[model samples]
Target: MTKFDEQYRDLVFRAIVDGERVVDRTGVGTRKLFGETMRFNLQEEFPAPTLKKLFFESAKKEMFWIYQDQSNDVRLLREKYGVKVWDEWEQKDGTIGHAYGYIIEKHKQIDKLIQGLKENPHGRRHIISLWDIEELPYMSLQPCAFQTIWSVNRGKLNCQLVQRSGDLGLGVPFNTAQYAILVHMVAQCAGLEVGELLHTITDAHVYDNHVEPLKEMLFRPIMRDVKPQLHITNRTQNFYDFLPNDIRLLGYDSHPQIKLEVAV
Candidate 1:
């Protein structure tokens, strides 16, 4: 019934009835589509998926791993956040080099983005790119949601997230929430209210192994009408000073967690 659930269900339904069968990097082939878009207005809702029990803590922690810690080390994620989602992509040296955090840290885009949002809100160049062409070979996995472009309209921050690939059952839900939160964080730092979040995925797909669970998720009813709220108590303008404790999710009443295997 909420925007998050509607968009999510629509995508799942698309994969079910219209998606084409195809081979992918993981031997677990997928029902694929070329492009799709979903939009969420921060003014209306925070856009947390209300239909399924999303790991809100893990989503926030992963965002912290990407932006706060600026780390590619999966071990640190496990140690700090109790999340092992990146363990498969991590190597012996404990890195997924130049993947997500590496790009932000390397270019210092986060700093520039906030500065640009303040100095030049409509610059048309406030962007962060995660896909590093030269460093691709060194990375254990290529960036999925590779780019994020930001803008300000009517003194409110807006974001357009472009993801090159998305796994419907697992990745998209978390990515959507994390990036929406990213928009909020940036807005708070830049002294602006939040606006719309535009998410565009180029290769959206559902893995073969996750079909059954995906179907089950589609059938489950959303438990409540109230959407989750993201509360950022950090008063500092400095983005790096934001500890995970600064952000919290409130009133996230939803259905049970849906177990679906990640395709490696």
Candidate 2:
């Protein structure tokens, strides 16, 4: 297994055996760990989890919604791409406030970040943030993978994401697959080779109800011999030009899907 897979498994196993139990927002209780980090070298292979199948289609749609569409409309995702994970977070007015894509749209974070990559590759200001303090109360949920900081070195693009919280069973894998796809897309558009993706989580936890499903994943053999490959069919240099059909996961081998109830 890749270190990405190994560390993910290790973290899950760690939570089962070593994490401290605490009641959380969902009231499901969680066996949680404080802080951890995992590195995935994009040059090596695509860092997709093989112990369990990833919903790459939905992940891609969600990522596209967050980055390209710059939207807070989960209804469109549900009707168009069958991505309903964010339905619970959608308010009655059909918006999640100035969180995530809403903030990106308002601030033009991705556009400016990509522009910086092309104009000033060495600039340290190439960052996109979704956590807006002013909009926190208006949002249904605070951002998790809140910020993305990009750096270009030697014609290769690297990215780091700081997530405030991670749900080990339900949210982690989707975030992993989606963000990895994003780095590849952005790198391709920016005409840089893929470098590495560093993911850091402040609070990583497995909910009580999710523990058993995670255990089943642990028992399965992870496709460790080789990692999957990502493909971008579009050669469009413009980051905003990417369509859902543009991204594809090739030769992604994995175990059967494991179902887990979402805490919220």
Candidate 3:
């Protein structure tokens, strides 16, 4: 089993077996665990989930929309990438408001991140935060995988994602793999080797409606022999220039996607 598969299975199992039943903002109740962490060595494997097929391309597009394009326009995602993942969160003005891309762009976080990693590989201050306190009221939905702290050691880039909430059935898979790809992209642009991706979630939950699907996902067999590897083709050294097509997941074999509803 891949590292992601093993860890995800354990998380789902624990959330169902030992978690507390609680009411949430979504109206859909959840079996919640207070905190959880997963570590992935990018050099060992790409950490894509093997039990269920990951929406890699759409996820990549969303990541680019947030970090690279630095845009909050939901229309652009729908029109250009044919991805409507954020459509449910679209505000009246055709944006998700001052969340994600808007905050990143406003602070020039990505630009500073790359510059920091390259200029001072040993710097302790590399971070990108999406949880802007003042912009919370304007956002359609608050950022879940909210912050990333980066560090470079011995020519390798390491990243830690601090997420406030994690919807185990839908969001966690995407967040873990997508951010791992981000580490690869950022490390490439910063001229460093890919290292570890530490994912820390403060509240990890399994929505009541999604429990069955999560169970099914856990029951599915993991493709233990296949090693998932991420391959990236860089046309430019700039991180902002990367498109979804430039990245690919090789040897990624998964079971058919288990349908789960997004508790919007």
The candidate maximizing TM-score is 3
Q: Which candidate has the highest lDDT of all?
A: 3
In candidate 2, list every pair of residues with a backbone clash. Answer: none
- Report the lDDT tens digits of candidate 1 across residue range 69-153: 8888888899999998898888889887668888888888899899989898889999899877888888888899999999888
Looking at candidate 2, the ten consecutive residues that score lowest on lDDT are: 221-230
lDDT of 3 at 47: 85
Give the per-residue lDDT digits (tens) of candidate 2, residues 1-264.
866678899989998889999999989999999887888988877877888878889899999888888888878778867888898888998877777889999998887887789889989989888878889898888899999899998999999988889998878878877888888888887778889898888899999998888899899865757667888888988988889998888877788889888777
Please provide, for model 3 over 1-264, each residue's C-alpha lDDT reduced to its tens digit, 9 standing for 90 to 100.
999988889999999989899999989999999879999999999988888989999888888988988999999999989999998999899999999999999999999999989889898889899988999999999899999999987788999999999999889999998899899999999889999999999999999998887888877766879789999976467887787998999988888988989898
Q: Give candidate 3 misplaced runs (Cα > 4 Å).
A: none
What's each prediction's TM-score?
Answer: 0.97, 0.96, 0.98
Pairs in steric clash, model 1: none
Residue 95's lDDT within candidate 1 is 80
lDDT ranking, high to low: 3, 1, 2
Give the winner by TM-score: 1 or 3. 3
